[model samples]
Target: MLHFFKNLKIFAKILSLSTLLLLFVIIVAAYSLNQTVLLSDKLKSLSKEEIAFLGVANEVSTLQLEKNIYIERALRLILKRKFNESASFFDGSEPVVNKHNLQLIKKTTEGVQVGLAEIDKLVVNLLSKQWSAKIEKNIVNIREDFNKLKGEIVEFDAKVQAFFAASNISSELIEGEILQLERQQDTIDEHIISLMAGVERLTLDIIQESEQLESSAVKRTVIFTLVSVLVGTCLAFMIAKNIRVNLNKGISVAQQLSSGNLAVSFVANQQQDEVGQLLRELELMSQHFRKVLSKVTESSMHISQLASTLSNNTSDTAKDTEAQQSGIEQIASSITEMVSSIQEVSKNAHVAAESTQHADQQATEGHDIVSGVTESISTLVTSVENTSEVIKQLAKETANVESILDVIGSIAEQTNLLALNAAIEAARAGEQGKGFAVVADEVRSLALRTHESTQQIQTLIRNLQQQASNSVTKMDEGCTYAAETVQRATKAEASLKNIASAVNTINSMNMQIASAAEEQSSVAELINQSVEDISHKTQLNAERTHQISKESHDLSSLAETLQSAVKQFKTN
Candidate 1:
């Protein structure tokens, strides 16, 4: 019942402990009370029985004194020749002695009783011898054989009277009678002495009996007191130790939680008490949190992968755009050179026509100018074919870059999904997941940034493709202009000299477009490097999440242990 109370609610536990202490005190008090009653009874018995025993012993002593006084009186009477009076005194003292002897039998033990019996026998023998001696003495005093001598002796007796009775006897006869009387008196005195000795022996026996009784009583009381004290100390120690154990368990739990070491294991107590219930609930909560963190960690890893792919595609697209811009500038420079050759061709043709006086020489000069024009036109055709090859290469590279960007965008979308899952998990974990959630957010932001950079690279790639297409168109226009200049150099020389400045302006604009594309490619490379950094961080975050999951499992195990430990206490 006490165990049941101790495992109950807090208030009940305190009450139970207090009740146990009170009960212990009550038990000790009861033991003392019982001892007290027993001692009181023993004391009462001692007061009644022992006091009565002593009183009887004292009465015996008083009787012995009275008998001694009576014996003295009896001896005086015997000396006066009044034997009857002495016998009367002896008889009067006998009752007191007999009464004392009988009382010893009633109040005292075996040894005192034996002495009283011996005293009674001695008193009877002494009285019997006294009677016999008294008769003998009287016989000697009377004359029975001679009648005349009897009458004369009677007359002599009357003259001496009772005063001379002791002297009239012969010296030898009187001495003999006195000796016999003295022997009888000595026997009586010895009997009185033996009776007094018996009384003293009885008193000594009573005293020894009282001391033994007192010693026994003391021994019993002391033994009981010692047992009670031992029991009380054991009860107190057990109660104190029990409380200490429970308090220590509570402290251990608090310390483990504070350190973020959820993996602490202890025996979970089976009791359904308040503390047990609380610890059990905590274990369940930790388990749930651990599971949620696991899923979040998996999702974060998937997002990190997508972000990496996006960075790769954006960097590839930027390189291709930079290549296409390089090709357009080469084509523009070819167009400018072809135009300069046409101007020179027109100038030489005019010089040849001015020398009419020397027709043969002028015709020869025109032929040489025609040959130079044909060489210039051949170079222009070669430049146009090379620009067409460059445009085709730019188109192919642009298509590849676009495909890679599409893949990056798709991965970015998937990362967003994983980030969403991580956020949900972090929310469930509450305060514990706050730091993890921040990392997840960073991953999401990097994914978005990579996506945005890919989009910019795509736009730039598109612009480069457009510029490449325009350069092809310009190359075709340069072809037409080159053909027309060839025709005009054959037919006339004035038109070819007019177009050299336009070719110079187109070449300058192409160089500026290549420079801008190079700058854009550099920006894309920087974004790709940032994506790599973010990917590395994401990987680290995933690892940390796994660690957290493992810790959560440990916490769950600890909760189970705490539950088991708590079960040892009986709540029922």
Candidate 2:
């Protein structure tokens, strides 16, 4: 049974269990619903048919009693009227008494007929088939008896009406009519009792049938509910137990795998359930891990062997690298000394070039100084020539001033002759001539001073002209001297230019020598750098070889450790 459940899929297993429980629930619900429907039908019959039948029966019985009372009251009134020999038993009229009794009896009879009709309807619509036939028969009998009683009441009312209508009624006739009515009353009472008994009996039967149906329906519902509960409990326990057992097996297998036991065996049957599939996958995983571990073990052993061989090869290479490094160091030392000697030669050549440049600069400055002196001397000669021309112009301007002074002297002499003639004419005119003579005397004295002043001016002019002439001559001499000095300075400037040119030639040769020395220095430095680079590369190679040897030894150790770690996993 477990194997069958295990072979089912996970969904199918759960679905089967649920189906079983659901089936039980459906059966219980269906049965209970059916029972409830039966009970409900019985209750509906009791409420709508059986209970209505009983109510209608009770109403018929009451109406029958009312009819009998009305009939009896009518008979009593007729007896009273017969015994008392009165015309009416009530209201002072025999016809009125008879009509009142007939109206009451007819009303009660109509009510009884209506109740019987309702009872007949209840019996026709009865839900209980077993009671329908018997109840229908009882209602038919009741209707027949009620009909005969109604006929008797009508016949008695007619006779009473006829008796009351006769004005000359005999006592014996009255007695005979009364006796007949009494007999009819007895029959009516018997009919009423029979109708009531039949209705009561029908009511009792309906009650009993309803109670039986309710009891049976309750029993069926209880039994089915208990059966469903029991079946569902058993199914749930079975499905849960099956699943738990399989899951426990899967847990055991997982525990073993967790402990790193790759060699542990897992066996599974052809179960398609979830726990079964999980166990199968675990078994596959264990097998795959076993194969991987086997390969890793073999690879680790091979790695250890290769690491040992690498260590030996690196050691031999390290020895060769050390010897090569020593030879490179010796060659580097010789090249370094050669580079130092070339650097010293380059330094001395650079100093000589700088000294030559300084000498050329001094020679150029000396040439510039001689040229500046020559320009100054030429400038001075031009200034002296301009000053000599200015002095010659001053001498000519002084001669023109002397000629103007001579013209002023001649005008002064003409005024003196005019004043003398005025004085002589005043001597001839007496006192008037005396006044004219005084004015003439003052005029003559002014003209004489003017002539004397003109003579002094001509003399000063001559002195000025002579000084100007002397300055011209002195400036001419100074100009000649300046011209000679300028010639000497120009000759000196030419000599200095020749010296500067020779110094520049020597500076150019020195620059060429310096440039050649710099080229040689650069070439020697390049050779020295090549030697240093080779020495550095050789030293680096030796160091790297030693590092490789050490790393190879470490690699062998790591491979052995890896092999030991892999040994812990049992692959076979």
Candidate 3:
């Protein structure tokens, strides 16, 4: 008996050790799974925050792009105008250069604004004063040179005219001087063409820089997202693996014990030191399991007898519950059929009410459209009246042009008279006045050409006035048609308003229909609630039936135990 007990102790130790190890493994596995879940949740939260931060960074990038575009445009405008002077932009600005932009974004949009403002002010000042003076001086010199050239052209024209009169002058000599004058005019035109080309090249360079900055900002955003994802993935994998390894060690110990090795124990070899104390506790519990189990076996045998009588009673109870369960199932089926019928009727009523409301909204939109059309037509008529007034102003400007032309003609006549007097004085002065005589002749011929040009311009102005008068007549006819269209549109709008008002009455009727449908829906909901209540009561009954079935199954298990105990006392 001692040997038997000794062997049993060994067996119980093995079995209990197996059980404890298995429970520990299960606990560890559950703990590991919990840790993985927590880490996964944390990673998800971090990813969301990272994504939100990236969005804010992207917003800053977008604002930076807008600022860059503004500055580049302002700079190009300055270069295009050929102004090279700078002006200050520091006047205690709202988005200060050294404050918000510098700190938050790590790039200064306000600094760029400051630079651009300075560039723009410089351009404005240069264009206003220095460039203005340069252009004015150059224009004055060019005009003076052009007037001299014009006088020379007139003298040459006169010489050609004189050559037509002079029988002694050679035609070759007259043609040679005319060719020389044409060559000089060509040289002056070439210089003006070169000046325009230089300004165009400077404008193109500033636009290219702005495009490069925007492309760079987009690249930075893509790179930041990829790096964040990679870091989160690595961190999640490391934490999950550590938890899983600890759980697997406990499972290995449980498997060894279940194979009936009494000496089975976990090797608590972790550097963390928590596994050491847990292994000692498991070892001590295993040493005493056999003694406790022997006492429990004796109690189990006595309990087995009581279970036998319960098994027979449970068998009788099972037959009764089957019939009750069948009846509850039939009641649940009947309630489902009633709910289906109510839903079908409610759906049809809802569809009809929706159609009426949609028709009302359409009528209201039509009224608004007709009203908009009337307002647009009225605007067109007003625009035509304003255009007629502008044409009248054009007519007045044409009249002014005619008056200026008349003044120019009178000035040319005076100039011609003065030149003739100078020429007469130079003729009396003899050899000393030869240059004076040439200048007087040239001025007299230029005056005659100017007088002719003025007369031609006056004739053109009169023709323009006649055309403007014809345009005004056509505009009046267009205005009259537009007024008629507006009147028709207004009448259409009034009709649509009446239609919309009628739709309102129809909509009100639809609302009452909808209210009736809602009442029907409420009744259906009550019926559905009653059906659900029936279903719940039926489910509760089913659950009670299932509980009875479970109790019967337990009773049968106990009855087997009772029968075995009763057999132990047989033939006493």
Candidate 4:
């Protein structure tokens, strides 16, 4: 029975229960209505038949009594006529006999006749109904008695009329007629008594039948009501218990899901009820969640491993960047020293040109001075060659720095891409990956900053390379001027007469060399400053790379944490 109810849909179950209760109510109502109709019919029967019979019978009895009184009065008048022999028959009581007494008797007999007619009509009506055999038999007996009493009343009335008619006869004749009328009256009274007895019997029988019908109606109504109540109560309890059990099962499954027990299972059934559908949906939801969490777990693990690898790579890159920055700083110091050396060469060239002017004033010391000038010019040439070589080396080193900057820029771009990928994965993880998303954003920002710094460094390196190329060009010009000064010094040594001219030319060349040397020194100073800026930028880049490495480690940690969180759900 429970299985049958369970198999039914929720609406069907409730409707079935209501229908049953309604059917029982309808049955009870119909039975009550039928009983009411039966009782109403019995009441109507009592009013129309038994009670009418009793009323007419009573009216008949009253008429019979009045007729009897009238007959007795007539009898007394006859007796009085027998006793008063001296008076005429129609003497003092003539008005009494003709007008009052006979008229009253005649009127009473007519009333009795009317009552009998009514009684006969009621009897015919009762017989037509075809009631119980016992009631019908009683009614038939009452009808027969009424007929007999009616015949007796007619005989008595005729006798009274005969007595009244024979008024001028003898007293003996009047007494004989009076005696006959008295016997007739006695017979009529006997029949009246029998008729009344039959009416009473029939009345009692109808009363008994009504009482039995009322008792049966009461007993049946109570029995049906009790049966309906018991059956309804049992049905309600069974339906409620079935519904409660199923609802409780659904609640249990929901509770399990709420508590994050993805491993919870629910058995499916063929029931098409609302609760069954809910349970099925919950089962599907649990399965879907389990699958999703399992995938999340695997993805988190992979992300963690990738983050770790990224962190390690980032750390190595940061170290390489730091080493590169240190090398660049050393190059900047070397360039500073080279700039100082170039300024010293410019000063020596000036002092050598002063010595050449002194040689023009003292011609006898001209040869020795020219020898000293030639040696100074040769040394200046050697210095210029050295400066040119240094400038070329600086340009080469600048090119190397540009290549390193390119590598750093590439690393920064790669880091940014990795951060972007991490952010995407974190987004895929939903609310669980909110913290990881924040970390990914931070990493991306750092990578962006690193990329910007790399770009700035590359710009600075390009400027430094441009400055180095300019410096190399200036150094080559200084070298050519030194070689020309050396040739002029050798010519001055061979001809004393043109020594003055040669000294002036040497002074002019020395001034030009000094100016070029000063310009080169300035360019070297600018180059040195640019190199320092590049070194500063490199340091900053290295620091950002280190930060990127740290962020990657944090990202790896976050991935591990996410994996751990997903592990709490027993998916698979």
Q: Best candidate, TM-score-wise?
A: 4
Off by over 4 Å in 1: 1-239, 254-268, 272-572
Residue 101 alpha-carbon offset, candidate 2, angstroms = 3.7
Residue-level lDDT tens digits of model 2 in 1-572: 76776688767977987897788778777876887787577556656654565677667667767766776777666666768777644445566656777888778767866875675566555433555566557656655665675576567557655655555455677678768867876776676567667656766666676677668877877887788778777877877887798889999888888888777777645778888889888989998888887888788888888878887888888788788878878887887787788778778777877887788888888888888888888888888888788888878888888888888999999999998888888889997678889999999999999999999999889889889988888988898888889888888878878887887887788778778878877887887788788878878887887888788788878878888887877666
Highest lDDT: give the candidate number: 4
C-alpha lDDT of all candidate models, in order: 0.55, 0.76, 0.56, 0.81
Q: Write the per-residue lDDT of candidate 4 for residues 363-399, one digit (tens) a residue.
A: 6477778889989988887887888788788878878
Superior candidate under TM-score, 2 versus 4: 4
Candidate 2 regions exceeding 4 Å error are 1-4, 72-98, 127-204, 218-241, 248-252, 266-268, 294-562
Which clashing pairs does model 4 show? none
RMSD of each: 53.6, 36.3, 39.5, 47.7
Per-residue lDDT over 1-572 for candidate 3, one digit per residue giving the tens place of the 0 to 100 score = 43332223333534644565566556555655565565455445435533443343344335444533443343243233324332222224323532333243223444433433443343333234322334435434433443453344344334433432433223355356446535543443343233222222222222232244345544554554455456545544543454355446656655654554435654644323233334455556545543444444565555555555554554565566556556756765776676576666657666766776677688778878987888888888899899999999999999999999999999999999999999999999999999999999999999999999999999899999999999999999999999889888788878877877877777677667667766766776676677667666656665665565566567657656655553432121
Q: Residue 125 deviation, candidate 4, in Å?
A: 2.3
Task: Select the stronger candidate by TM-score from 1 and 4.
Answer: 4
Let me know the TM-score candidate 4 reaches against the reference structure. Answer: 0.50
TM values, all candidates: 0.25, 0.46, 0.37, 0.50
**Cα-lDDT of candidate 3:** 0.56
